[model samples]
Target: PGAAVVADAGAREGASKCPFSKENMAMEGAPTADGLLAGERYIAMNRFQVRDGSEAQFEQRWAQRKSTLLQLDGFRWFGLLRRVPPTGEAPDFEYPDDYSYVSFTIWETKKNFNSWRKGPAFKEAHGGGNIFSFVGMIVNGFMTSKGPPKPAFWRSMLMEKTSDEKPILRSGPGGRPDADGQQTLDPEVFVSMNRFTVAEGREQEFEQRWAKRESKLDGLPGFRYFQLMRRDQTPDDDVNYISMAVWDDRAAFDNWRNGDA
Candidate 1:
């Protein structure tokens, strides 16, 4: 073994630059560069201040009705998420659970959502509501070429295997960062998840390259953490890996997205 060490040292010197680094030089986690997802768009909906006691009833109702919304033309994908709390406390996070429950549904067009909102189905599923009743909705504008402009919590309570999917149901506690209440997230947390596909034969290289790039990111201030996760038990067509990152504030997140930081 000792003699083999000398032989191995003579065999290869330093680690070679990731062999597959040349495939796509765009930003590490940018989603638009991948071919399969180019035309796809994202829509995010957030419902806040859900009443503590009514959480069960609220989920029951949404479960009963979510499938109907998917039936609408142009509907793409959907997710329901709860916010995570921060490390210490946030100035804006007033209520115990500042973010409780939210439903994010993606569609093919703004027109698709508009048409559905005005139709009877939308009204029945999500049209009129109040936070006290454990119901609320905030529709974000379409996701353009730029990914999320700021560091914010975005997760898939239910992610699909194929483009056409029937979301399998899962259960959890409240949203918005809070202490151990079945569901927990940090307070100063501004988190977001972006999905990407590594080009064929480039997976190994991409991992090596990201390891180097992420190491440098730690030197910057307010950078909390970055994680790369691949879905488990996923179908063949759904090979998208996720990158979830945390930051101190929106300005810090925006700086990274805008290339200023």
Candidate 2:
């Protein structure tokens, strides 16, 4: 979710809330191979509603922190975007009209995220009585491990790709909004990260279980698509996984949640 647009004076909560760490340092031109594939980390997805008619102000506020955020310990990438009109290219299962604007950021780990969240930055971004803000967590789920023999592949896929690139669901049929207004949704598109701990030696069984659940999701009316993925190269934290899905609308997503789908 998005934080409310406020005067710059009101935006500053404290420095610790938006700490300057090694990862937050700004990089110029393009990122290096080592820099891009830092390590496996958690994902934090934020949706914000900038104050009405204050889109410019909201963008200005974000501009102030670009360089600093780049150098943070686990800093990956950040995208600030506005909603677009729905197109026929969108899948029938997708909700055309949803959120107006959203911002997505990636961090190397929860610890890295804590830097900005624990202090003023969090309050300024979402707190401080900011009704214009919404935030959600994206968890990493591990599916496999090849020990250390395949370090490059592991790092490239697990650590690098998942670090701060755009999420899989960003632009797809599942995310598009409808033009007719015939389909109503709850919150439009609401994304979150989840973790399910399986018993040791039950990894295969767990995958099988999810496969069944995901298969059933496909048959549901509002359910468009659901994706399950694990991080790339690093093994110590490869268990982390991410699930992204799209629905027909808010009501459709709610129906599934309520067990009415």
Candidate 3:
């Protein structure tokens, strides 16, 4: 079982073409080559913790770098998510202010993502010294390799997108409040990324558990969307998964974690 990966919504928007259009995504269908079907799509998640007061610089560099990804083939959509601070006391896993940002990208396939990493764009965007130095050091070391490095830098593949899952579309930046006055999730809403590592041959069991728990989550307040993802498997790697959830605020998330769900 892989861990759940949560991504907040805070990345600079790129002018890329999103494969999952509102109409198309709303259709009830099987996993299609062009749609978010289970086991068909890949998600690349990059987590970061910028130095103090450098959030603006980090975002600017990310926006510039994202333009390169958008121009590549198979690129779908990208979002830079900032971790929202809890209104009450902090959770145990909460990091200090430093490592609080995450980048989420969707690709058509793992092969497509691998190709982009080997192409010139990857070199230009990440070769030079930038804010990604923390993870770049590990990434750059594998520049000569054909596939991604071992222990991927927060990369995971889409294993399951349940039929009941709803797409949380936003009208604009920062999202607007709903009819009930509850804030609909946008880039600024709090997000939780949970990652897991499952033993081999247990993928089906893991998904079953998720399906059962998801029903209760749907009824909770502030819960917006959820996606269960598995990491691309290598010859020697154990199975991995990520569960991503979006929430209107920290209180709602904490409520579910505490007991409501």
lDDT of 2: 0.38
Where model 2 places Cα greater than 4 Å from the true spot, the runs are 1-39, 65-67, 89-98, 119-261
By lDDT, the best candidate is: 3
Q: Model 2 residue 169 lDDT?
A: 39
lDDT of each: 0.39, 0.38, 0.48
Prediction 3 TM-score vs. true: 0.52
Candidate 3 on 1-261: residue-level lDDT in tens? 000011112322431111122221222321222322256567765445443344444444443332466577888656667665555655535654234555676788777876875676655655344433423442232122221222222233333332355564422222222212122123445567775766655666776677566356666777766667766433122336677776776787788889845
TM-scores, all candidates, are 0.34, 0.34, 0.52
Candidate 1, residue 160: how far the Cα is off, in Å: 13
Least well predicted 10-residue stretch by lDDT in candidate 1: 1-10
lDDT, candidate 1, 154-204, per-residue tens: 222222122223233232222222323333332233555565666755644
| Tens digit per residue, CA lDDT, model 2, 1-261 | 222232222222431112122222222222123223233445444333333445443443433322345445777655444443333244433322233444556666657776765655555553255412322100001101111001111111122122223234332212333312222222334443343333444544544555555244556655654444433323222343455455555566567677843
Error of 3 at 141 (Å): 18
Candidate 3 ranges beyond 4 A from true positions:
1-38, 64-73, 84-87, 91-99, 120-124, 127-187, 212-224, 233-239, 248-261
